[model samples]
Target: MSVREATPVTASTEPPPPALRASARSRRRRGGQWWVPWLFLAPALVLFLYFKFIPMGQAIVMSVQDVKPYLGSTWVGTANYGEILSSESFRSATWNTILLAIGQTGGSMALGFGLALLVEGQTRKLSFIRSAAFLPVVVPMAVVAELWRIMYHPTSEGLLNQIIGLVGLGPSGFINHPDTSLGSIMLTGIWRGAPYDMMIFLAGLAGIDRGLYEAATVDGASTRKRILHVTLPGLRPVFAILFVLAAVRGFRSFTEVFLLTNGGPNGSTEVVMTLIYKLGLEQNRLGVGSAGAVLLFLATLVLTICVQLLRRRRSA
Candidate 1:
């Protein structure tokens, strides 16, 4: 091989013209101005401050005070939080919230992912099936709640009870009974949310490299092995995203629980949000409600961080 002498890097010893130097200095100054980035971010920052941070501050402040609607407020210094913490209802609500998050997240992810696998990348004849599966997702939550309420009727005439009768079973108290109320509402939530998760999982599955499956098959892997070794590994990101999003959404769940049980049948379905609504709106204990809200916010924040950390660890 022919060898060539390497060129040495040289520094410019001569100074530029004063005007060019000034121009360069100005450019550097402009580049370093911190406010330039903030200028672009100002709108979003203002909205977030107004809508999210400011409200959060207000809630934190309110949590320590006694807030009576129209009657004015008084500083109580953690009394509201103390009262809630000491209350049986508050404890029950917190426990219920945890159970709900677990049940809802697990049920939706399981059912949705299962359904996605079943119909994954099917032919035209199966294309229409996803649309029908997604029908429950489009229905308004209030309507779904009411519909499920009717279906959950304790009497034999109720849809669910009637279906059970067909299987040679007797009528059972679903949402009408305290012991089963939470589970019944959970089923309703799973039914409503599963289709949405299914769509997301289907999208993830579709994006997976098909050749991985082919390769797995050629390696004499069974169907289950293909899913475990090829499919699931490729979907780690999607799983992480869905897990966090679903858990966060589960934290704020109130509608179906409200419409179905309204934290009733002996307060068995009283999740934190419902309790907050009761405190802030119906019972007019805004301070206590705000405290509960703050606790929920913190819980969600912690849960989110934990999930993200878990995802990072798995990825690493």
Candidate 2:
């Protein structure tokens, strides 16, 4: 009698209807099967296998054989490698490549990082400066190289030499003398490349939390101290990317050097890729060129792997 009939026991255990069913945005639909993404990637994978990997494989095979465009390849089993190792041209090319890589990479990174730091602050008004810095990157490198060739004409009327003359320095041998040719090319490479590197650095800098800076300042850190501790540490990942990319770019540099001097001034600018071009395309020593190319690929691969390992270690 005291139970009051229990309201006919009609209560249900189901969840309540959501108050606003349409309020929660739906997740983008994903493929039902795990293989769906692989399917989507098939085209790119096939293209890479065909274009990049196939060519790379062919190059490797050609490196071990005496090869040419019209001539049949004769397998020589490391003879090509042996010849390259013993050749004076290869030695000179290797040395020049090392110097060029070091110079370009160092110069580009230094200038780019400095510019990035200059522009990445909260001051939104300096966008013009950023644009100016990056303009060279967007311009065709061939055009820049051509412009620099005019500026580096190794005479009094050359634009760079004229500017130097204004500063009381006599005419300089910019691209003519062996002593200055590679250095001159390096200047152009660095100047044109720094802006591109700066863009990457800017992106990395933007990802850094302002709160970290505020906290560091609260702890009485100086500007340089904050940069050393917070900014640079935060940019290690970016630095890895930049380093690998710059190294690769340095290794692959062709157009500027090709147009500027064609590895001239007594082969002072004969970097590996340039030497490869001369051997394969100009001299028709396809096997030797392929060997050089293989070396370039190996060098690039090693650099990339080392960078990845370094990043992992730093992050860990």
Candidate 3:
């Protein structure tokens, strides 16, 4: 047998090819730039920290102390909360807030659902009308309040009064009268808020399966039956979201009440936001105001959590 010559063994001491080195460097550069997204987020973070979080922290601290402005604040340990709870005005404000939230949420959703039904089409005319109807939403709340204030002028010549007069109804005091003040404000809210709700409903309607409607029609289902069985069931998620949003908006209603009534005419229209303003700025009772704010925050948090839990349960 002939013996084969053995090849010499050697380790590969040469560097990795240039392509491998470039790829390694690129990966290192990417790892080092991991903070790029955070850098972009820094401005918003700073603003929220200064304007929102810092103020919230200060308010929480002040809730336990009697804020004396130029003078030193004195710690009172929930005394402010006690005072707020016991106050008659605060009680009234809480009741009014609940009433307004219910009224606005229901009214807006009803009106919006109706409007969505009327304009659920892909025609120029329908689109134009929908846009026109949504004008109230785009108009600033301040302007809406001012415009309604004029319409509700509580005189024979007032816009609403004139229209009612055509039907032989007498001039009615709207926001001007204590008996009707809260209702009038609530109506204003509903009118402005309905358009936003309408937009959401339109989006929801678009998401519904068109085949469902066709199948129902083929089964000789009436329009109302189709809506009840098909449209309403499909829009459950939209309804849930709209309810929360409308409720929160109603509870946070400040600009409209402040500009329109300012919690006046015997405080009939006084809501929690107006009450807080009165306590904090008008009365200079910062501690009490802070406590009220904290309570409001907690209430809102509870409401959101309850809604979420309910939604999850329903889905399950």
Candidate 4:
């Protein structure tokens, strides 16, 4: 038997393959260029810092002090908050805000979901219809407010009143009367907001598993049943997202209400934002207004956090 000679094997010291070398170089380059993105973002960041964050910080500071434009602000501690919290008008505004939020959020979501279902197709007719329906969303809020204001004129000659007259309904003082002011504003909000929600819902619907619908249909499920069991479940995340957006939007509603009713008819449509605006700009109660604004910000934050927590729990 011949004896076999064993050779010692040495570890290869060659550089990594071209692909790996290129990846490593790319990562190193990316790491080195981390500041590049910040450089590009500098202009926007500076604008935000000056216009947004600085004002936000100033607001927070002003919330705790009495702000006088010429005389200068004085430290009032928490008195501003106390005053705002105790004001009867503020309390009423808060209540109205909550009611308006609920009405707008619920109405917009329901209407948007229905519209999404109706227009969920790739056909040209459906596309055209969707675009037409979305016009309200794209129209400036001021324009929408003015448009609705005209339609909501208390006179019988008003566009909306004319339609209601055909249905045997008498001309109602829509925004002029306190009884229907808030509701009239809510309808305006819903009409404008539903299209945005519909677009979001259409995107969500596109992401849904079509096979599930097929299977449900194969199982002889009716349209309502399929919507209840499959569609709703599939769009659960979208619903949560929309609910947060709608709630936040409703809570901060100001422009339309300001333009249309201006919290008129005994302050029936007075929302928190309008109240804050009145306190700060109109009445020059900047301290109290800042306090109110802070409270609103906190409320919105809490609402968002609660919604996020609930969504996480539901997802789990």
- Highest lDDT model number: 4
Q: Is 3 or 4 the stronger prediction by lDDT?
A: 4
Candidate 1 residue spans exceeding 4 A from truth: 1-52
**Model 4 misplaced stretches (Cα beyond 4 Å):** 1-9
lDDT of 2 at 234: 94
Cα misplacement distance, residue 144 of candidate 3 (Å): 1.0
Clashing pairs in 4: none
TM-score of each: 0.83, 0.86, 0.88, 0.95
Candidate 2: tens digits of C-alpha lDDT, residues 7-45: 567778886567544333222234246677898999999
Highest-TM-score candidate: 4
1-316, model 4: which lDDT tens digit per residue?
A: 9999999999999989999999999999999999999999999999999999999898999999999999988999999999999999999999999999999999999999999999999999999999999999889999999999899988999999999999999999999998999999999999999999999999999999999999999999999999999999999999999999999999999999999989988999999999999999999999999999999999999999999999999878
Q: lDDT of all the models against the reference? A: 0.91, 0.88, 0.95, 0.96
Residue 109, candidate 4: C-alpha displacement in angstroms:
0.7
Clashing pairs in 1: none
TM-score of 4: 0.95
Residue pairs clashing, model 3:
none
Q: Which sequence of candidate numbers ranks them by TM-score, best first?
A: 4, 3, 2, 1
Candidate 1 residues 160-206, lDDT tens each? Answer: 99998999999989998988999998898889889889999999998
**What are the per-model numbers of colliding residue pairs?**
0, 0, 0, 0
